[model samples]
Target: MPAFAQDSDSETSNNTMKNTEYVTFYPSYGYQDEGLWRIPLRVWVHKHGGWGGKQLSKVAKRVVRNKAGLEELHQDQIEMFRFRFRDFVADSQSFEAIFLRFDQDPDEEVFRLQSADGDKRTNFNGLLFGELTLTFERAEELLTAQQSKNGWLRFTATGKDHQGEGAVRLIKPQGDSVISDIDDTVKITEITEGEAVVMMNTFFKPFQAVPQMKALYQTFDENVALHYVSGGPWQMYRPLADFLFKTAGFPPGSMHMKNVRLHLLEGETYGDFYRLIKLGSVASEQQKIRQISEIFSHFPQRGFTLIGDSGEHDPEVFAHIRNQFPEQVNAIIIRDVVNDATKNPERLQGMKVIQADSAFIDADG
Candidate 1:
């Protein structure tokens, strides 16, 4: 939720700017507990392969875009990109420490710095990693949920070679929050079509949101916090957020996306295609389990409705979450993208699993 809490749903901004230089921050969202406000902000710095890779890429692009030529060009470009991107983790340095400042009410005021406090140093050991935390002991603005469940904090991150400024949101618990998946459930990725579909969706095509998702979410009153939790890589977090707010009229909340591992690739361009084969793997299954369960753990008392598609193991993963947090998980909603496993039912255990063709259909059940 880029704009914070909107209407009645949770508005946590999963914002990231795509740039060749400096660090990129994932869509940062936080919930206030009691008087404490915490934001798990993640940032990554890009030193780039710098001018060498840039010039080389330019030269390579001029050589023609054939498969053989493109592959070689990508290899060179990746090597160069990785080279400068590794200086932060060299043997000489244990970790690079970066300073940060937080302003509760960012304005030209008298007690500006006093209103907010994030004057601390965060140690970064990885080029692309979740670093630092903004902890506020007395978050009065955020604590006043009676007035409004949302508040904003302007923050600045500074290092020798990097500097960035952005706003972190605070959403105090209202009531039930919906944790939804992006791929097939909320958007049409054509998972049933496999590799060709993945390639088309990931690269050459415009992302399409599922029908009636915006109007469907609005049916629930303004207080239902809506969080989007997806296995999509952090690399595309911004694009996903853009689609949520701009393309679809759904209000934002906490958006949690998985980090991209360098090893999770088949090819620079065709890596996404491998997801078809990896769909039901034990590894991917466990990942989905951890991703969604951890969220349930964090907000133990908040009622949640788990939403995902049958394309992957969202059903099983959500099933595990229902078992793990029996009291917290309200219901498991799985969109039938593939087989109607719900007829006989898969491994749903004793939880209430609802299978539907669309999220808008039979959503009340």
Candidate 2:
């Protein structure tokens, strides 16, 4: 995996340290491979100037007005926007490595994260906007030092003078599992309602869980592992994570989301930032397929229940994955966001489709 750094890494490290910064350890999963434990550890490092000033809000409103729609944003919407957008406009940090402490005391042995391809330090694209994500391959004996009875472990990480904590869920080589989509399946995004509506729901409105969706997930016993794979960008991780595991009462699980980056753009204007959001947030079918396939390859003896929404390409993507791993995929459930799945059979030909207002869904076939 490539390294992640901010666009302004050329600036002095002292200057970067003076600025208010934050770090996020995205939830990841661990697996045993060839007598070793490996974690696809993902971390994001950046600086936030805080939301006390409206300068950031003004810029964000301009971007939303130009990109989301011509409608004027309410005061509440602007406040909501600032909460998530605070991390988006911040500068990413360039660090040689991050320190990791496993499920031991603070004085225990700490490990450093590094790439499998022999890059001693992490690399980051100096983009003007968007979140910076660092994914490292760590195959170490530290994890195996302590066995977990519940098949999960917790770890605290510190890097670039920022402190954050994350957890990893380990699945057995053979068991039943559920791979789910985030946007319209469990959370309401109104994706089929067009770009403006999608933006409003994503940035402006309060996040609401699909009726009884949390209860549906609760039905899965501790034996069945959970994975949330979404087309959303990693920048949305904080809000989404809280909404899922905290506010909405859904089970905690490993997350896999699209990387956030706008390449070489300066991102100084509203238009540029709008393009960053529009261009970078779109879902890549191949990306979803490849991510799910990696999970399947990791646990060939496991059975999976694929759950997604009909708003986008979940049906097609799930169908493709089912075809590729016929023995592993036991069922496919598609939440009908458009409310026309039965009318258009071809769209979800062989998959199971439920109504938009479905109060419950069965993952067990």
Candidate 3:
């Protein structure tokens, strides 16, 4: 018999809530206490507002009004369109609580979460986002659950009329780990190529992995855990996971990302839309620092190899992180994206720099 079996089967198949959608995300494992493993549960509940031409037209018109402001307006339209329609569908439904359960385990249990506590779940401030990140306590039994060879354990989440599957990677406190950046380092999103290109590559184009990076990641033995820390908002987690782990064949690990919510703009100006994008860009550096610091602090006994690209503030951020946790951070690798003849020695003063084109052979030799 499974634990919490009653709660797992409690939600009935009611007619009114049949259209709900649940998107389960990669959850992070917390520290172990007296035989219990701490697992942070994350789930998104919304209405499936399918991608339709009418929705696109409505959003585009609200964003782009005249040709005089076409360029900036196009950028805003792209942002609104990508967020408002694809993947992230701001639901009209309001949920005060939800339930989650581990899959493929004989003793799997269901956990209930409330929305009153802002950090544990999305309060009124994040109601528009529908992202609930609640922590599960005394969950040590989960460690015995079946896990993929790379340490990922599967789980199912359900709320009202929605249901979905997600996984969490269990890592020990003491081990070698790799903390990689998603953007220019592993996946190719040209940050230095301006907003239009960034939006195009992120939303429209197929995601491409940096050549050799996947192979480099696979070289790590079982004792070495993996993690992906990025400035990209949590909304992009599903697509990014599919591209990196499923398609590119990189090992699965914990995902740490910025909490950003995008809602359909009602009577909002172009300046308002543009400002949100700008704020996210500026906050990227700080977000990475905070997330990486948390990971380092979470596993104080684990040594980390930080990987990022030179197209942005990665070099500076990694350098700062190393300064804070000099003992735990074993290496800081900056992938050279900026084309400087001298390898930009001053910019990459303290880190090991690699060229994307030759990183494989370079790392192997």
Whole-model lDDT for model 2 versus the true structure?
A: 0.66
Instruction: Name the candidate, 1 or 2, with the larger lDDT value.
Output: 2
Query: Which tens-of-lDDT digit does each residue in 1-365 have in candidate 3?
Result: 11110111112245454455544445555444345444555555544434453474457454443311334345654544444334444442344355667666565566565433443444442232222232343233443455345445566665455566666565667889898988888898777665556655665466788877766777889767777888776656767776787778776677877655445454343333333332335578887888888778778898999988877777778889989999998887877878532656787776777776675636532
The root-mean-square deviation over C-alpha atoms between each candidate and the true structure, in angstroms, is 8.6, 6.5, 6.6
lDDT score, residue 272, model 2?
38
lDDT of 3 at 218: 72
* Weakest 10 consecutive residues of candidate 2 by summed lDDT: 1-10
Off by over 4 Å in 3: 1-18, 33-35, 50-85, 114-122, 125-150, 261-280, 340-343
Output the number of the lDDT-best candidate.
Answer: 2
| Better model by TM-score: candidate 2 vs candidate 3 | 2
Worst 10 residues of 3 by lDDT: 1-10
**What lDDT does the true structure give each of the candidates?**
0.52, 0.66, 0.61
| lDDT tens readout by residue for model 1, 1-365 | 23321111011121232221244445555665545555665554443334554454444333223321334434654443233223212121124444455544333222111112443223342333333333464445323422334454554544454444544556556467788888877777776675645544543356777775555666776666667776665545555665676667676666666543332222442243245222555665676777677666656678988877777777778877777888888777766666556444544444344444544455444
lDDT sort, best first: 2, 3, 1
List, residue by residue over 44-131, the lDDT tens digit for candidate 2. 6665553432465566557665556756877887778877565566566664366667655434757666555644344562111121
After aligning candidate 1 to the native by TM-score, how far in Å is the CA of 180 from where it should be? 1.0
Relative to the unseen true structure, what is the C-alpha lDDT of residue 119 in candidate 1, on a scale of 0 to 100?
Answer: 30
Off by over 4 Å in 1: 1-21, 31-35, 47-137, 141-149, 152-167, 261-273, 276-280, 341-360
